[model samples]
Target: MESEVSRKVDFSIIRYAQCWEDPEILLEVLDIKEGDVCMSIASAGENTFAMLVKNPGKIIGIDLNPVQLRLVELKKAAFLALEYEEMLEFLGFSESRRRKEYYGKLKDYLLGETEKYWNENMALIEAGVINTGRFDNFFQIFRKKVLSLIHSQKRVAELLEKKNKEERYEFYNKKWNNLRWKILFRIFFSKFIVGKLGRDPRLFDYADNTSLSAVMSEKAKYAFTELDVSENPYIEYILTGKYTKNLPFAMRKENFQKIKSNLNRLELHNVSIEKYLETSEETIDKFNLSDIFEYISSEKYKELLEKIYEFSSNGAVLAYWNMMVPRSRPEELGNKIISLSETAKNLHAIDKTFFYSGFVVERIVK
Candidate 1:
């Protein structure tokens, strides 16, 4: 497999503090239970925290990016060191004038590397770690510069308040969705801009066959017209800078005690998925690999899948998403893999974060 260092130019930076996919839908499909040893990509650690609520026997999170692993460690430390309200304040969910002092307290619970990382990125903590990453920065530009010009804050908030799908569709079509909106949306999320600002340019090759702008437009339409935006934190954060009533499961108040109690269940590894799979002798019962396949070549993806198949236990379920780029198991492995395409389709219909073009779940039959 290609190393992330050679593949992504922005590997060192914090690319995402909050993941784009909805973990609620993901966990529904995951159907995790006790005694399950799960494997996941530690993107922002949101899904990992969600998995902990399931009371799994073990969860091994792997990430090639050190910054991403640091974020997870910081969160784990917050749970160990701070009270619920104080944890929220330190995590940027609420305001705190003494974040530095709070960090001083939290650092004792963190590893030396993780503490140093947060110490170096104190500005990010002060500004709200949720909105500080590069991907968030890209969205900030669009929200402030383009989206703000197209619609007023009240109008945008109103779009979230519609009672039903009919009401939403009517409001979106009549007031929000216009030629100007389409033109600006296309320009802002076009391949040229997203490739540079959001993700690496090399990943664009896999999505060359599809229209990136159209996928984005369709996703935007679904978020506005079909899904309930009242609790969709992804959209809430993108439009406004905060999560009011609804936050990710990891950050929610009720789940804090559960996460804190089960903190020992989660283990973090600063390594690639392939590396972890190769070294890990335990069979993974559930796999939550985000869109990592989108970044690699088809051959590399196939190789990685083969490794995953080897690491996974029989009947093990796996879930992943297709952002603009699409990927699937090689034809040669069809007999060993059972596709959950229909379930994926049904779940995709109600996906709160309509960012991904496709959602796929499969099981190992062999």
Candidate 2:
């Protein structure tokens, strides 16, 4: 199979910020806080910027891909630098039947660089995100096309009206059960949503076909917070996409309401965790690896730790996670592994799905 995660970023912020696989619930497990310097992989720019909401001293978001970097730049541009409400309307925050108003809002805000990118990379903006200018009309057109093709036109229309989480859950579970599904999901959701959406490409990315199924199953069992909708409403909505039929909160402009004044604190980069550690002029108090090590091989896992150990001072706190795959880690790193009992217990107490496989690991620098 073509490796989808071959495109997976090293320290992407967007993936963590947008579709964290468990947004509203994973906060406790992440244990990240304000005034803390956080470093995360920038995937979609969502979590990279979202870190600002917590009032971090500095959020260093790093990625290698120019396209991903640009997208985060656009989110930062649209939110940090642009007019707030207009940015939201331009990026599909609320439901609107008035398509012209949606498209009109973006045309006004389109900047020079963003406009050039839009004109030149229209295909990317269609399949990807446009961070610089107004993307209202662009995405609206794209959304229409996707809905038309999915044969989900009315379902998409009805979904737009869902204003909050509860309504979204009800609509998906009982009303649009059929419409609430994706072929990808029917084939992969139960097993691979977390893996595909996870921080590591190795556990999900480099797996053998047989192992991929097991990875998917492990991922689904942990992330499937939707056992009974009444009991686990958020998980139900997440699994069904019944909630927030719109794009994720990170993509919405309203998130800036919480992050507006704190934008400058948002520092973005395009580098690996290793490269960032090697070259940065910063000391990180907290790190969210999001299972970064799951991507490394037996030999590389050692190198990953050597890099982490090089920067980590004794007793310095580190928070990341890994899959406990059979023989996943070589003995060298495993020998140094010290599971912070206090943090591990807290993760168990909190049923956040991303860290669901008891994926939270809090280790102090030895």
Candidate 3:
């Protein structure tokens, strides 16, 4: 049976244009070995493709939303058909005026449905597919509407400037954290506003009761002061409209050819994780269950974990994020799954995506 959140939230459109979870942290925790089969939730298909760079034998990308699966197919076609620079340009990393022309070139590589979808939505292709998601639009609004009210272009640029720990902290405290910034940020990021505009309200059903805006504001502070803004792509995309200094793992130039070479290993399925696990014959060595627990009930979370454990091989790793609702290996499964809490904590400290409150990693020992 589908969960209430799943039944309520609209899935016909893309929720995330880019996977907000940090692939760096995911790769670190999963530690994929050569020839290992992996499974990942296909949100925008970024992290799933990122894993291909590690030379995994195969990667199965499962998503309940068919539109998201189309995105994965579209991205796969882009990697197969376009060169590195062209891929970046077509995917909205670099500026390009010929995205429609590029789409023409990629048509031969896409599946029938994917091709039809892109053909129908040529405007999204022309506007750059990476910036077309609802989440990306939310960031665009924050960048253009809310951010402009708080800081000028010069101040925003200064915020992104390379700085040491002491300098960054001082800058944030003295110049960046003004009263206007705080008030406007809270107003824009409040649960009600975010639910209506940024994300589906059902996503927050299991979210913490504390002020969502306040928690997010503190997370932003950590990203601003503690992390290196110059290399953080999430912050860069949120502040500016596009990536400049660093790109996500799948989009990096060095990994492009490698991912392209291993494109044969990628597979996409439009099905729930539970459904996929029930039918999957392969023993998965790593699972990138991207923050899906945040939307489901606690009972369903535990039930899904057990299903995953049944399909996992010995020493298989499971990594997921907690945006609001805290979830991890249940006590009943403690003997079967070993918690790697210390490793998760260390990785969470350096996680590039700062919005998530926790990153949990566990291993099947049996």
Candidate 4:
């Protein structure tokens, strides 16, 4: 028999350094207000910073992975210790040969653990923290090796310049969409590979068995052929390994001062959402769970939803993504957990990153 330690999954390492969700849709659905305390899962901490723009009283970002929370702390430290442009360089959003020196400057701002963590993993920091994680590394490989083979840099830039939707669709059909694109994409981004590298393997247990390649192909076609890829920062970042004009609010230069001013209001916790909720006495005004439900089990999801309901105040909004897995509140809890499926659907339609099968929004009734 396997030892308990060997059998248990360890999630303390870095999972994602960049968020894949569309913060625009989330902010629109949440409509966060002043004096509201928000709870969010700190997957790369992108949405956490996005949520801060609304001037919420507090935003607590909790993650099962300590390394992920460390990244969040490093981001906060960047704002505290560096200027707008310097912050970009320090976070690995831009090229800089002095990143190690910058890290040294910001070391005082980080917690003892966060500073020590960075010191130990200096190689990741030197390479650029935003580009070193499993998910980011996978995307980098996909972009450089897979995407570069099919579409030349000039061709992709030209496609983004196309304004007319009909013209873009025609261009994609004629110049881009083909059997080769589909086949290679499927082989590289398959569920087996994604689970092993991009996400936890158990997350795929409840994920749809249907061809992920097909699902991804459709999403890719929609993003590239139908939607304006220029405005979709997630796609742009995945393709180029960095953001230009379009970026998450956290990384944008204009928002840097605002984030720095409000950095004190944000808190980072290295704990599972369920564990945090069970121990905390705070009445959460909003919850951003991300796609964590897909990673756990149906029963676990139900149990956590119940805990969320218990901890929520009136008008508390909850948001999460349903990737390949389909998860919903049990009918027994329907009276308490009111479905905002229609609202979620509207947001999903306009989501910049159309990777997930569904985006779920719900409210706990008073």
The lDDT per prediction is 0.83, 0.49, 0.90, 0.82
Q: Could you tell me which 10 consecutive residues in candidate 2 have the lowest summed lDDT? A: 130-139
Error of 4 at 88 (Å): 0.8
**Model 2 spans > 4 angstroms off:** 1-17, 21-26, 81-85, 93-116, 122-211, 214-255, 313-315, 321-337, 341-358
Candidate 1 vs candidate 2, TM-score winner: 1
Model 3: CA > 4 A from native: 1-5
Model 3 steric clash pairs:
none
Write one digit per residue (lDDT tens) for candidate 2, span 307-342: 665666454445545444322234456445555656
For model 3, the local distance difference test gives: 0.90
Over 4 Å off in model 1, which ranges? 1-6
Query: What does candidate 1 score on TM?
Result: 0.96
What's the TM-score of each model vs. the native? 0.96, 0.62, 0.98, 0.95
Off by over 4 Å in 4: 1-8
lDDT of 3 at 259: 91
Model 1 accuracy (lDDT, Cα): 0.83
Q: What range of 10 consecutive residues in model 4 has the weakest lDDT sum?
A: 1-10
For candidate 4, what is the lDDT?
Answer: 0.82
